[model samples]
Target chain A: MIQLTDVTKQYPTKSGPRTILKGINLTIRKGEHVGILGRNGAGKSTLVRVIGGAEPPTTGTVEREMSVSWPLAFTGGFHAKLTGIDNLRFICRIYGVDFHDRLDFVKDFSELGAYLYEPLGVYSSGMRARLAFAISMTIDFDCYLIDEVMAVGDDSFREKCKVELFEKRADKAMLIVSHSHRYLKGTCNRFLLFRDGTIQEYDDFDEVYEKYKELLAEPQTF
Target chain B: MASNSLNSSSEGSFRQSLVVQGRVLHALLIREMLTRYGRNNLGFLWLFLEPMLFTLAVTALWTATRTIHGSDLPITAFAITGYASMLMWRNMPGRCINAIKGNTPLMFHRQVRPLDVYTSRILLEFGGSSASFVLLVMAFWAFDAVALPEDALQVVVGWLTLGWFGAGLAIVLGAVSEKSDLVDKLWPPFSYLLFPFSGAAFIVDSLPDKAREILLYLPMLNCVEFIREGYFGTKMHAHYDMPYVIVFNLVLTLLALGMVRMHVVEADYE
Candidate 1:
């Protein structure tokens, strides 16, 4: 279970302090797949980052009874100068998981073959995403925070991700943030429409998607 | 009743959290080594080799130049002790100042804290420099260039005190550098200015009475004096107050902890 109480995030801008999240109270229980939809700059990514325990709220508390994974498809955590296998080993060590046991799995799943031994900085963006996705899948977490960047790679890789995340690990909770309405409709059990530094939840996905479209059509306020 | 259970659970989880932190630090240390040294030629050996090379160059230069201070100590031994001690305290804060900002993405992992980053870098610097110091002394002894330390325990204690002082200062600088660029701009010149007075180049006893009194207030000076006394023993008079160095380190450590806590609280994550 994950709970955020009175969470607000603000960033210092040249003009002044810009408030990203005004005041957010959210809770996600086990086995719930939540999809967050928002227009550009609506703070969707920021909200997921807060839920994943990456960013601390300006003024609030986060309570977690379950282990949370880093944002899926995030390649930033890896040291660019290190080999892909070395990066995986480091991540496994930090998570207290045996890298020796999972080594074969990540190597095979990433499908980069000999490239895994090369430095991550040498890999293309698509290969890096594949490696990141494979590593995230190898580590078992109670909740996974996925950003839209998971859409990288070929069609077959997307299918592989679907089977691995949705079919193989159907019981795990997830908070997926994306701008793709069709993708959310297929994956999410519930929907969250983010706007004006706040989130509105809807059980029926179609209703929220329509409202989201309407909001997009209106002129954005500063 | 709910609050009671919550408090108990949190208390129970404290030990678990520490275990998690330990694992994270171990991982970070390995990552630091891999990135810093790489896998190919002379990997990891560079940790000690780098410092040893620097000390060797300085020692050779002093020996060749015959730069005699008022001390009877061999120029080679003097250079080794002084340069090694200076590197121990000086290199740490230089490495730590921007460590967190450079690895901002690592903070995405909840187990990795700003303190962990600082601690790992500081430990690496301390460990590498200390190893180099010991190896240099042993090599010099084997070649009859320098004698064994008069009191091994005193040398160890002095080195540890210097390490503590360096770690404390590094934590404070690292934390402050996160909030402002002023530290980044000023630290290099400030460190250079402090180098002459660090007692790395001259013995405290060699100074005049008034200069000696003022130099005693500097913790790095006291550390160097203690270490030199251990090596030179009765051959030269050494003056240092253990109580003064200990008290200064303790107070600085406390202040550093407070500043680090503030940085963690105010750090902006992307």
Candidate 2:
């Protein structure tokens, strides 16, 4: 379970302090899938980071009872000079899992074959995304942070991921951030919309998405 | 692990935090080694070999100009002791400054804190320089080019003290450099500028009382003087106060950890 109470996050800007999340109070229990909807610059990513324990809230508290994965498909964390195999080993080491056990799984899942022996600097974006997804899946986390960054690979690969995540590990908690209403509607049991530094909970997808469309049409304002 | 009553990782127990840090450091150490050396010929052996080669060249150069080194001390021994200590204190900070900026991606993992990043680099540096120093000393000893130190215990203590100083400085500067661009720009030149006064080139015993007093204000100089005393024993008079060096290291470590905790925010996260 993850619980956030009176959480606020802000960044220093040249003009002044820019607040992102404001007094956010939330609780996510086991097996809950929460979809987050926000336009660009509305702090969906920050909220995700805060929930995953990657970033501390500016004020108030965040309590997590379960292990949280890093943002899915975040290739940024892998060292470019390390081969795909080495990077996989590194992830395994940090997560306190055996690398040899996961080696075959990743090799089979990522489909990189001999390329896994080559440096990540040599891997294309699609290859990197595949590698990232494969590596993160090796770790067992109670909650998975899914940013839109996961929107990669071909349709078949997406289908494979759907089976792995939505079907295979459907009971795990997830906080998914994306602009795709169809995807969110298909997967999430709960919804939160970000506006004016606060989150408004919505149970009805059609109602919240309609509000989201209206928000998109409105003029940009802080 | 989750069976414990404590739910929040941020507020997790001390033992849990330590285990996590150890795991992160192990992962980071391997990552640092591979990224630094790559799959090229000789690879991570360059860790020791690079420093060893530098020391050997300096030893040869000093031997060629034997008369100019300002003391009757064996140039090879002096070069090994002096250059190895210098390499530790010098490069650790260089590796640390802007470390977080280069490693912003790693910060995405909640387990990879700023201290782990600084420590992994410092450990790699300490290991490389120490291996180089020990290898050079043993190799030269085998060849009858230099005698081993008179007091091995004192040498070990002095080397550890010197390492503590480097790690403290690196952590502090690494944290500070993230907040200001000036630190990144200034650190390289400052490291070079410190070389002459760092007691890496000349013995503290060779200097006049006044000059030695002034130079000893620098901690690395005092550390080398302590080490040289271990090496040369009664042959050379070493000037150092262990208490002063220890206190400085303790305070610097406190300040470093404090600054890292207080100052490091998420780097460029939107």
Q: Name the top TM-score candidate.
A: 1
lDDT (Cα, tens digit) per residue for candidate 2, span B1-270: 222212334455778767877888999987887788766748767666766677778888877866566678887788788889999998899899999888766765767877788999999989878888898889889999899999988999999999999999999888989878898899889989998789878887778889978888889989998998899898787889888899999999999988987777532121
Top candidate when judged by DockQ against the true structure: 1
lDDT of each residue in A6-37, candidate 2, tens digit only = 99998888899999999999999999999999
| lDDT against true structure, model 2 | 0.84
Candidate chain B TM-scores, in order: 0.90, 0.90
Scanning candidate 1 chain A in windows of ten residues, the lowest lDDT window is A48-57
Deviation in Å, model 1, residue B218 alpha carbon: 1.8
| Cα lDDT of model 1 by residue, B1-270, tens digit | 011111113343556766776787899888887787788748767766776687678778767776655586877788788888899888899989988888877867776778889899998888888888998888888989788889989889999999999999998888889888898889999989998899877888889999999989989989998998888888878889989999999998998888876656343231
Q: What TM-score does chain B of candidate 1 reach?
A: 0.90
TM-score for each prediction?
A: 0.93, 0.92
Regions more than 4 Å wrong, model 2: B1-18, B39-41, B265-270
